[model samples]
Target chain A: MIATKRRLPLPLAALSTGFVLLWVFVAAFPFIWTVWGSFKVEQDFFSRDSWWFAIEGTRTIAQTGSAFTGDGYYGAWVLRDFFSSVVNTVIVTVSVVVVSLTFGTLGGYALARSGYRYTFWLLMLALVFRAMPHITLVSGYLLPFFEMNIWGYMPTAIIVLVAINQPFTLWMLHSFFLSIPKDLDESAMVDGCSRFQAFRLVVIPVMWPGVITTGLFSFLLAYNDFAVTAMLLSQPNQTMVPKIASFLGTIQQEGNVMFAVAAVVSATAPLFVLVLFFQRQIVSGLTAGAVKG
Target chain B: MPHRAFFAFIMPSLVAMLLFIALPIISVAVQSFYVQHERVVTEVETCTPFAGCTKETRVDAEATEKLRNEEPLGRFNGFGTYLDRNHLAVSEIGAILSDNAGFKDAAARIYNLPFYRALAFTLTYTFVVTPFAMLLGFCIALGVDAIPPFYKGPVIFFSLLPMIVTPLVGALIVYWMASSQGILGATLQTLLNDPTLSLKSSAAMTWITLLVYGIWHNAPFSFVVFYAGLQTVPHDTLESAMIDGANRWERIRFVVIPHLMPLATFVGLVQLMDNFRVFEPIVGFSAEANATSLSWSIFNDLRGQVDQLFGSAAATSMLTIVGVIILLSPVLVRTWRDFNRR
Candidate 1:
């Protein structure tokens, strides 16, 4: 039993459905194609004879004696030492997330609770900071980092990433803190708790949802970063994104483009899982700022 | 909160930002006024038994290192780097104009300069992609809203993948697919009836490819925002509009658009900021020969083959910061007014 009043006309319904399906195909097809292609040899994946060869893996069978092979993965992970880069990425992203959240929460809470005019200016400054091209900042850091003899360490990169993550983190957490009823903390203060104690005891418990959302963004920033990691990191301390980039340079020269392909798929897999699990939080975090504005 | 407590609470974050963010701008500003010290060359007369004595000039590496150690900021060059041929090229543009070249010729000459070329592409990409992405996103939001609720979740999850993926990786995926041997590229070549046709083969095709990539990467963000905004459209207002003899289109035009206007501004602002700094796509696409952005120019300078051009990179960085401020002025002014009103 369809509600006739609310239903779209048949033609319009068909058009809209077709359009939505087209968009989905456009969005998801490339990743799916690449993932499937990662299993095949380069000739099969980028088949010039016919596109069906990509799907059918004709050359893949001839080259490896099987339609699917782990040669690319083996080359990237073992011979190229992508595992060390993965380890570095873990250390950097984890440290950045933890430090950014710790600092962001305190700063964001203070900004939300404060009544002074300077708070507004602080936020405005952050807006300007947020808009500055990140490479510009990297340019600034290059000389000083070299002079200080700390140019290529994981800790230096982590601290720099945490700093870069602050403006967005502060703005997001500030808005989220605003949404929390002020009375929850005010009431605690009336019972003789200091401001810090009140925040620690009362606000902390209820802050996880917002903190978790902001933390997801921080993790993404640190993980997806290319400029800082590529420029600031030593060769041995490179992260996954930059490692994939470096793979393009060296592996492509070795005539093993499939290694880069496999690494790309490997890098994307975690993000796929991330979106699958935290889709709700990522969406909310994105809309949180927009909806409030 | 008390002043002391507020300061104490914000100290760590504020210090991090000031030290890392604020200080870098100052450092860039200072570095822009100085060029790297030229190699200290010394003239020496050498006497040999087999040949007549000849004067030779050689770089005094030890002395140069000493000078560098004493003053690592390099030799001060005032605004020389900013006005150099690689950058603003004030005198070169003046020469072109004075020579009475045709407007198109003059424009092309100016665009040939590295800074202007990057700036032109950056502004064009930002302006073109932002609106198109927003419109496409709004349409997609409407389409999703019209669909059955059960399918919306999966649609959103897929829609988000383009944006959730790293910009570099996402661009690489498109780059690989559009390579001459790949499926889409091969299909296009056949359809166009030209085996020579490749997206990366020409400047125009490369620009179009990057623009399409930009739109695809950005539309999902605006889509998610607009979809969320669409959910909050008032049911009562829509019902009243319908009862007042307004058709579906009119009802949407009159009520829904007004409600979504603020969210549109939010999306536009964020997109403008992000798009202005487009760098990774150029790297991923390996389209630096065809296209570059302001960020890419800075990266290029910093990663020079022989020695890093710190002064040149810093000058470009300072200019980029100024550009960012100019882009953000309107929003900042509005926010300032709102704050004062409050």
Candidate 2:
């Protein structure tokens, strides 16, 4: 195992894959555990009975053997407002996705195309807002907006989401925009298009691949954002990320009753949204401080 | 014609950039000086409408603005709030730099070192996780790249799930897993024969748990990046390498690594920035603080301190940003040029 495989030890590879999956399992556990326990009775959710209670432990010491029927999921749905919550999530996520993509794409194009004096500064500026912990910014601005009586619903969530989205959109799209040769714009202009016209007619269509990737990445970003949305809206139905965090908060009180709904809905909704716009070129729009042209 | 073209082509984006991106940063820099005009020690300086403040004295001035604005910022004396002036105007750039002692300057406090510590920690994290993920992602992509008639479509679907999931959710699961008796801890305790291994320990547990968890949560994104990079790796070189009896290592190191370098470098930088700013996972993950970092300073200034001395937090955040730029100014320039060239 040590000597014969690829450069890294074979055991290391095995351990690496094991560790990766273990990490994934751990990473995925809250959702997975919540989803699993969501199906159990309240008493069963407690330990001494544990995750894999045999038929003896689950049943009433009866003839055959049985676990509780799919009551927990049903409990989550009927009692927890989970369906409504899921619907709210759908609305929030879909709306965020739609909005972030629209504005972020256009903004990215402009930054990519502009001859501004401080391009790096502007890019860094946009990214700074995004990268600075959302809690810090939201904690700062949220109260001000609240006092002005301005921040709420689509306006608040979407605006905050869009602001966060714009940074990545600008940096990522700059790359995508740059990747497309300047010839596309120049040739289109030579054919009698104005600058805007060339961008719209010639550049945009070609930049479509980059545009979709950048925009979709923006959507995913906003779709998962928690800290700002948690602070800004505070309404149960406002943003799913906060709502999931809210559900986690109540775990001590409701335990499995609510977490089941949180785990599945938060976990599944993003996945479903990603698949809807899924593609071959979804190389993350975000890179480390460096990314390739 | 030119005016209309410029307005139509450029105005909205520039305005948006100015309104959202530029204004926020400039405001933060400005707010740092005006912070607690009575309490702060540094002298004031003005530039433009911001009520002039020296850039050096300004910290995460933004956080101060956040706090001051929270309860009616401008209703009093022109809406600016927060500051940390030297007040004394010392001759030799102050005592802290010269004497190498005492916590006199804003930059010398216990909370100040976290940014530097986080820098080293984040850089190590970025360097550690990226190349391995790049390779691992390639292996996964290759496994699915030329899928057989049966396994073709599902492998991509199976493999890319992590990319689709939210990092918050992933971090949450990590919290569960690394909790003292989290499945990982319990399993490891038994395996390693250590009864007293806590996830909150100052040694390996806290940092390693966080990094390992981060790497796990992040690999999918890297996978997608590398997979895309791999798809574009021309076939001829790979085939020619194989034909020339070059070993896999030789081929990957000589042929593949260079080809992957540009993308790898880009991803590496992205990892650096993201990992350094990692707050959510570490914040609520366990009680122990990554206290040495700038984020903790900002958080403490805002969330912990009474009277909401937002000036301190703002200063901390400003310091944090400067630290970020200092760490990556070279990469930032290269990246700027790369985007502009086309």
User: Per-model C-alpha lDDT, please?
Assistant: 0.93, 0.55
Best by DockQ: 1
Q: What are the per-model DockQ values? A: 0.71, 0.21
Give per-model TM-scores.
0.98, 0.71
Docking class of 1: medium
Please list the residue runs of candidate 1 whose C-alpha ends up more than 4 Å from where it truly belongs after superposition. A1-5, B47-51
Query: What are the per-residue Cα lDDT tens digits for candidate 1 across B29-118?
Result: 999999999999999999999998999999999999899878888999999999999999999989988885589998998899999999
The lDDT, on a scale of 0 to 1, for candidate 1 is 0.93
Give all candidate RMSDs, comma-separated.
1.6, 10.0
Which whole-number lDDT from 0 to 100 does residue B156 have in model 2? 48
C-alpha displacement of B276 in model 1, angstroms?
A: 0.3
Model 2: lDDT of residue B104? 52
Mind giving the per-residue lDDT tens digits that candidate 1 earns over A225-278?
A: 999999999999999999999889887777899999999999999999999999
RMSD of 2: 10.0
